[model samples]
Target: MSMEGFSKVFEMYEAFRELSLSRHSIREFRDTKVPQDMVDKILELAATAPYASGKKNWDIKVIDDTQTIQAIADSIEAYTTALAPKIREDFREGFIEYSQSFIAFKDAPLLLIPTFKVNYSLSLMVEDEAIKAWERDNYVKSIATLSMIIHQGAHALGLGSCYMTGAVIAQEQIKKIIKIKPRHDIAAIIPIGFKKER
Candidate 1:
């Protein structure tokens, strides 16, 4: 290759490399609305994530209603109320800070919950032990792969997101609010919006 050709190729490669590394987890967001088209594109790209047995076992629920958001916040507060005294104190200060961080979900325009269904069952028979182990490993790997793709796609679109696993811990409350099926479980709650300029 000529020197000029080599330099051009290197520049393009570096640009793409930087794009991949530039992706980050954004917690704070502005009050701007995230366009529906952009949201659709993020989910579409996230759907390209690989799956075991070529089965897509993931589902997403987008929550944007004011009533629903208030219900979720209430549920979280109620759940947190039962914590041990010491544990509660430890999280009290942090929880206040965290609460402020999530003000974007209510103040901004979008919030999403991603759910993963684990259909692979482990048999009790000794003969099925190896198969069960393989299935378990495959199930976890597939879910992790899906999350990475989804997060990366969101970042690429200039949208800010925070993966709230704590929200998933309130699965029962979330399920009730969202009316999810019995087989489905909350995986992560990703609050998305425009990043507030620092």
Candidate 2:
């Protein structure tokens, strides 16, 4: 390769590294709304993630309604609250407190839920049940990779976002509120917006 080409490659690597290192999981966001075009760009970039068997068996659900966001947050808190009684008395309070952190996206202007649809896997042809189960998990790994790319894309677009799974606890309630298809399950929930001033 020419020296000029190598220099350009190095510059791209340096810029990517800087972007990766600078991103933080932003839990607090300002009230500013994220532009639809910006969100579309992030999703477009995330679509490049490699998936199993070269098939992308996932869909992203973007939520920007304030009432819906609040409803989802309330459902999560309610779900965790229900679990409190099942916990040991000593840890009960701590568990509830920790769960509160899960709803940090309640105020974010946008919420992104990546849903995964389980499809045919060659691993299922194997005789071992354990191996099949383990291989099925690769679907999740692919979605996770896509999600990370979404976060980086958001950061590059001058927005803040957080990757969260705690909201999965309220999947049942959330399903009722959202239009996600029955075949797909929630993989992760990402909240994006402008970062709140510290």
Candidate 3:
């Protein structure tokens, strides 16, 4: 191919690669809120992620209410505040920074919880212990994979988002607030919104 043609191809491929790499865990967001239809579109992409054994394993529990999200963020901030000092010195500083992120999440417009259904593991019906263990592990992996796809999809739509497992520290309280079933596994709490440019 000519240099001109090759350059076009290079730019085309680079555009796609750039989109994938540009995604960062957004901590701060703008006041604008995300609509449910937009979120549903992202969820569609997320649900396309591949899983081992073709076993369906997750459910996206999306929360958009400001009051509830604020409460959840408060719980995370308070918990992290109490725990940060007691953690190992190597992790102390990062933990403190992450706690601030939790506090910031209060302003986010959407929160998505990609949960691994615990009942899916039991329903796998594999009698062998080793295979069962592997299946259980992959179920969680599948959920993480789904969350990553959704995060990317959100970015593609000009929105910023962060997948935060640190917020899982408030899982029980969140579960009660969200009314998640007992058999659902909380993988991570994701916050999505318009990011304020630095």
Candidate 4:
């Protein structure tokens, strides 16, 4: 292979390795605030990620208000507390740990909530049968594609993020507090900022 070809291959490998090693669930963040422009750029890049059937199911909400952040954290706590005994114990410990590791969204200066919009109706008919089943399958496929695309974009931006399913458990309350529409389902919550060294 020519020198140019070898250089391209090496560069690709290096980029891949860098993202693999650097992409981690970050629970700690520096006290500094992330620039709004940088956050917007990352979100724009994430939106460009491929989707199934050309449908974009992911909707992101960037929360920066301290009051709203506290509301979200409170809702998350309440939802987690109400889970079945066995499951609660298993997750409560980790939730507490995560809470301590990262400051509440208020303290962190940035919070990102990604939601998946469900796009199926029972009224549709396919060959005389209701199209609900097919619609659900397609919705799931689209959400999966959105997730991969968003996370990959985040990794490429040199910003560390942790996918919080805990936030999803309190989806309804979060939606109310964040003012997201009822049709949009929360998928993950990411609080992005500079990483804090252990």
TM-scores of the models, in the order given: 0.75, 0.94, 0.77, 0.75
Off by over 4 Å in 3: 1-12, 81-98, 102-104, 119-133
For model 1, how does the per-residue alpha-carbon lDDT over 85-166 read when each residue is reduced to its tens digit? 4466766777755544433344445777777666665544445867877866676567667677767777878887766676
Q: In candidate 4, what are the lDDT values of residues 16-63, reduced to their tens digit?
A: 788777677766677777778778777777777676545676677888
List residue ranges in candidate 2 displaced over 4 A. Answer: 120-127
* lDDT at 83, model 4: 53
lDDT value, candidate 3, whole model: 0.81
lDDT assessment of candidate 2: 0.90
Tens digit of per-residue lDDT, candidate 3, span 1-198: 999999999998997798898988897888787987889899889879997657676788888889998888777776788887899999899889766755556778888888876434544665677776776788888887888888888998999988888777777767766866568878888889999888
Error of 4 at 122 (Å): 8.7
Model 3 TM-score, all chains together: 0.77
CA RMSD of all predictions: 4.1, 1.5, 4.2, 4.3
Q: Which prediction has the highest TM-score against the true structure?
A: 2
Scanning candidate 2 in windows of ten residues, the lowest lDDT window is 117-126
TM-score, candidate number 4: 0.75
- Note the Cα lDDT for every prediction shown: 0.70, 0.90, 0.81, 0.67
Per-candidate total of colliding backbone pairs: 0, 0, 0, 0
Model 4 residue 26 lDDT?
A: 69
Q: Model 1: which residue pairs collide? A: none
Q: Worst lDDT window (10 residues) for model 3? A: 117-126
